[model samples]
Target: MTTHLIDKIAWIHLADGRVLSTRSHGRDRYYLPGGKREAGESDLDTLVREAKEELTVDLDPFTATFLGEFRAQADAHPDGIEVRMRCYESAYQGRIQASAEIAEVVWLTYADRHLTSPVDQIIFDHLHDQGRL
Candidate 1:
C-alpha cells in the first residue's frame, strides 16, 4: 500500500467572528492562506513565505502562536492520502490581495463551513463553538 502523507501549515486569521480563506485558481473550495513548507524551512518560515506568496501579507513572527493541529483525508488526492495540517494564530501586515495562484480571498463564518475542506471544517467547528467563527 502507498501512503500519501502531506505536511502543511495554515494560518487562522480571525476578525469579527470570521476566518480568512482563499480560493486558488481552478479550485472550488476555499482554504486557509498557507501551504506546504519548502525544504529545510521552519513552520514560521513557511508561514511568512506562504502568506506573502498567496495573500500578499507579511506575517509577524513575534505575534505568532500555535492554534491547533488537524488531520484528514486529503481532498482531491487518491485514497490513502492523508494531510496533517498544523495551524497558527498570528498577526500580519500589508493589504491582503490575492497573489500567486490564489484567485480570490474571502472571510468565512460558521454559516460558510461547507465551502471549506474537511480539516478546515474542524477548525470552523472549534472556532464557532468558542464564539470566534
Candidate 2:
C-alpha cells in the first residue's frame, strides 16, 4: 500500500483554556487557523498570510513560536492518506473573525476534540496534556 502525505501549517492560539478553531465554508469539522504553504513561501509567510485570510488577524511573525508537528490520517481522505501539521503559537493584532473561506470561528476546549479533524485532535490532546487546554 502506498501512503500519501499532505503538508499543512497551523496556528495554535489558546485563551482562557480554549483553543481557536475555524470551520470552513460548507465543512463540518473545525480546524486550527492556517493552511498550506505557497511555492517558495517560508513557514512564517504562510502563517501570516493564512491568518489574515482566514481569521482577519495579523500574526506577529517576531512573536511566532514553534509548537510541534503532528501527523495523522487525513480527515475524509483515503486510508493511506495522511496529513502532517506543523503548528505554531503566536501573538497577533486585531480581533478574530471568520474571513475568506472561513464560515465560523469558535474557541474549543478539550471536550470538543471530537469536532475537529484527526490532526487537530492530536493537537488538542497535546495541549490538554500540557494543561494548556
Candidate 3:
C-alpha cells in the first residue's frame, strides 16, 4: 500500500480562547485560513498569499511565529492519504471577511472541534491542551 500526503499550510489565529476558521464555498467543515505552497514559494509567502486570498488580510511576515506541524487522515480522502499542516501564528492588517473560495469566517473553541477537519481537530486538541483554546 502507498501512503499519500497532502502538504498544506495554515494560519492559526487565536483570540479570546478561540481560533479563526474558514468554511469554503459549499464545504461543510471549517479550516484554518491557509493553503498549499506554490512552486518557488516559501512558507511565509504561501501564508501571506493564502491569508490575503481567503480572508482579505495582510499577514505581517515579520510577525509570524511558527506554531507546529500536524498530520491526520485527510478528510474525505481514502485510506493511506493524509494531510500535513504547517501552522503559523501571525499579526495581520485589515479586517477579516470571506473572500475567494471562502464562504464563511468563524471563531471556534475547543468544544467546536467537530466542526473542523481531522487535522484541524488535532490542532484544536493541541491548543486546548496548551490552555489556549
Candidate 4:
C-alpha cells in the first residue's frame, strides 16, 4: 500500500471539558483544527498556515507544543493509502471563524466520538487512554 506523510496539528482548546473541532467544506466529518504540510514547510508552519486558512485565526507558533504522531489509513480517500498525522497543542488569538475551506465550527465532548473523522477517532482514543478525555 502507498503511504503519504500528512503533518497535522490539533488545536486543543479544552474549555468546560470540551474540545473544539471544525468541518471542512464538502466534508461530512468533523476534525481537529489542522492540515497537511506544504513542500519545504515545517510542522509548525503547516499548522499555522492551515489554521489561518481554515479558521481565519492566527496561531501562535511560539506557544505551540508538539503532542505526538499518529498513523492511520486515509479512509476518506479512494486509494487505500496511509497517512502520518503530527499532532500538536497550541494557543491562538481571535475568535473561531470558519473561512472558505471550513463549513462549520463546533465544540465536542469526549463522549461525542462518533461525530469525529476516522483519524480523529484514533486521536480520541489516545486522549482517553491518557486520561485527557
For model 3, residues 25-77, the per-residue Cα lDDT tens digits are: 88899998999889998989999999999998999999999999999999889
State the C-alpha lDDT per candidate.
0.90, 0.94, 0.94, 0.79
- Residue-wise C-alpha lDDT for candidate 2, range 83-122, written one tens digit per residue: 9999999999999998868999999999999999999999
Model 2 segments more than 4 A misplaced: none
Candidate 1 lDDT over residue span 47-114, tens digit each = 99999999888999999999888888888888899888899988889999998699899999899999
Task: Per model, state how many residue pairs clash.
Answer: 0, 0, 0, 0
Q: Between prediction 2 and prediction 4, which has the larger TM-score?
A: 2
Ordering by lDDT: 3, 2, 1, 4
User: Clash pairs of candidate 1?
Assistant: none
* TM-score of each candidate structure, all chains considered together: 0.95, 0.97, 0.97, 0.88
Question: Which candidate model has the greater lDDT, 3 or 4?
Answer: 3
Give the clashing residue pairs of candidate 2, or none: none
TM-score of 1: 0.95
Candidate 1: residue 102 lDDT (0-100): 90
Q: After superposition, how far is residue 26 of candidate 3 from its true place, in Å?
A: 1.3
